[model samples]
Target chain A: MSKTPLPDDKAMLDDIAAIVEKTGCERKNLIPVLQNIQDRFLYLSEDAIKILSGHFGLSSCEIYGVATFYNQFRFNPPGKHQVKICLGTACHVKGGDIILENFERKLKIKTGHTTEDREFSIDKVACIGCCALAPAVVIDEKTHAHMTPTKIEGIFLGYEIEKEMKIREEKKRDDKDTPA
Target chain B: MMIIISVDDKEIQAEEGTSLLKVCLDNGIYIPNLCYMEGMETPPSSCRLCFVDIDGEKNPVPSCSVKVREGMKVFTNTPRVRGLQWSAFELIMSNHRIDCGSCLSRKACPLIKISRHLKIRLKPFRVGHINSGNEDIVEDHPCLIYDITKCVRCGKCLHICEKIHGRLYLTFAGRGVDMGISFFGDSDDETIPCARCLACVKICPVSALLSYERYEHSPEGSSS
Candidate 1:
């Protein structure tokens, strides 16, 4: 536990408070409230849920039940990059499971889990509605079609390089802003 | 208005739009199910055991979610339906703990009855079990005991809570493979106690939810 408060924690709380105010704290607004919270936070944190429960006068259990029933909601904080492997009917027939297994092995993390460094997280989606591109994987909103086990290593290597470049660029900008 | 539907070649007169599952059970036709509550408007259709082949449909459908129609033909014992039901049963039981010898709800457990009806033996260690991380029996509440390892995620308890209390205290937490029921709020608070209705326990298809007192004095405890 760091003594310094996270800069974003207050902003996140303000956003949550605004959403709750807009939703009017009704029992029926639970789903939409969750959707909004997830949209803001990238996932539902325990803190956010506890706040929502307080506003709605519902127990944590009730809120959790609704969240678990649906496949869309995520509890853990999302990685910087999201990797979704389509496991739809078309993809499944075209060896999507093998591709997914390959990703899991390479990332050293199971589906729905972020890497230890929090760089990437993987999820198995029912479909992206792109059946033509069987065995598809979407990384940070970019679709990679006709994926295979061999292609996964190269794809991850590309992301790693991209991350390094971004970090270098950010460091250069920070140095330029500092006094001589 | 009454409409006639043929279930297993026996023509039964049922009301229009009534659930085929309700009709079958009313007529002494057993279709195994775990998620269908009597008054629930929108059925969860989670349990795939009630699969039945209707005339003109290529694949079997869950009978609980299907409404009976006039001149409709339903085949309850078709090969495809049995195959789907068996696979669903096996999949559900794969994650379930099968320690019936020491379990409290042995005599009344619906999973046991359904398995026996399907003639499938309980093979505990055949498939890998889901580690829900809720293996410890929750004894926080004096009346209710929850052993999440035995839970089937049937949604029965959640629905019953809503029906009885107008709001649910128990709810599902997590998603996909990690999903399980969790109690909300402080369990020690006496104002919102579990109602002690036992509706959830009575409705549980497995022994996941048990009465703390009954569990202590269960059949297995006598010899021990």
Candidate 2:
């Protein structure tokens, strides 16, 4: 992928304007409209939120408050692979704590934290409802249930495979550029 | 135009262009689902539990999000699909609070009802440092209570606030593990419109959001 950023603010703002019109600019309709916009754009940009606030005749804080109140709205960029650990009742009772601890130690990030490489973001979720298989964790939407601290290394290695391959490819390019 | 769609080994004809989810429900072909309210467009495909395998796709896609195309082969219930769905279900249930006995939507919550119907007999995972307790629940103001522990990040609450209120108030603050709802501009009572619209409460599939003065236990609910 090129180092260039995706799109400019103007394009993003225009896209938000389209959502505002389609949502009918009703007071109650703001959240869905924003959600739709966010679905298109990974996160809600400040410009988009400002446009929505102006169209809805609400303050930016009001707009931002609702956006920040739900788990689906993302203010920051997401990782390539998202890892979520269930910490609900059954899982918690069955050593879900140990699993989460393992992830934190291995990823060097706690729940609600993302690795600097942007490869992974680890989160703690409530019940995924697979209680019979307590202490489960989901990586990139693939669930790994009944996990033990021992199994975490394997899981991390699975993700690390892709990460390391990418690093090696980049290093090869740099080596070719060295002076003779 | 009527089109035929296959669920497992059975083939059924349905009106053209209806959502696979609606067709399945009409035919009594229960393709597992959550975050999809029959009447609401929140399509809330956000939950990812409605995923079903179509013939050629690499990954199982959410049935609720895709429209049924002609001659499309759909696999509703399968060993692999069930496992994937079950895994997703476990993820949501683990992160969600289990005080359903006292929740208002305990009887009506889709997640709870669907789990019983699926006869999900296993508890594969559990919670860690993020304790599930009353103290962890957020009673931030008079209008609502946000129990972060019970949330599934379905975007249903986000839709309700934006769709009905014309104001983008609260939203998911971070990505991945740090992903949870947060307040904007000091999420305080004075700042909140306190509309008490109950959109967030009504849309939540779990007990993440609740009314301020709810009392009494939840009534009997459906396992269907």
Residue-pair clashes per candidate? 2, 78
By TM-score, who's the top model here?
1
Worst 10 residues of 2 chain B by lDDT: B215-224
Candidate 2 C-alpha lDDT tens digits along B54-85: 89988788899888888789886666777778
Candidate 2, residues A110-163: lDDT per residue as tens digits?
A: 665678887888777899878888888888878897899878888878767977
- The numbered model that scores best in lDDT is 1
Worst 10 residues of 2 chain A by lDDT: A1-10
Off by over 4 Å in 2: A1-180, B38-44, B126-135, B186-193, B215-224
Which candidate gets the maximum DockQ versus the true structure? Answer: 1
User: Can you list the residue pairs that collide in candidate 1?
Assistant: A61-B184, A65-B172
DockQ of 2: 0.15
Question: Is model 1 an incorrect, acceptable, medium or high docking prediction?
Answer: acceptable
Instruction: State in Å the error of residue A144, model 2.
Output: 37
Interface root-mean-square deviation, candidate 2: 5.5
lDDT of 1 by residue, B1-224 (tens): 89999999998999999999999999999898989988779899998889999999989999999998999999998888888878888878876878888887768888888888787776533455656544457666657777767788899998998888887777777666567767744465465656457788777777788776667787643554
How many angstroms is residue B172 displaced in model 2 relative to the true structure, after the best TM-score fit? 1.4
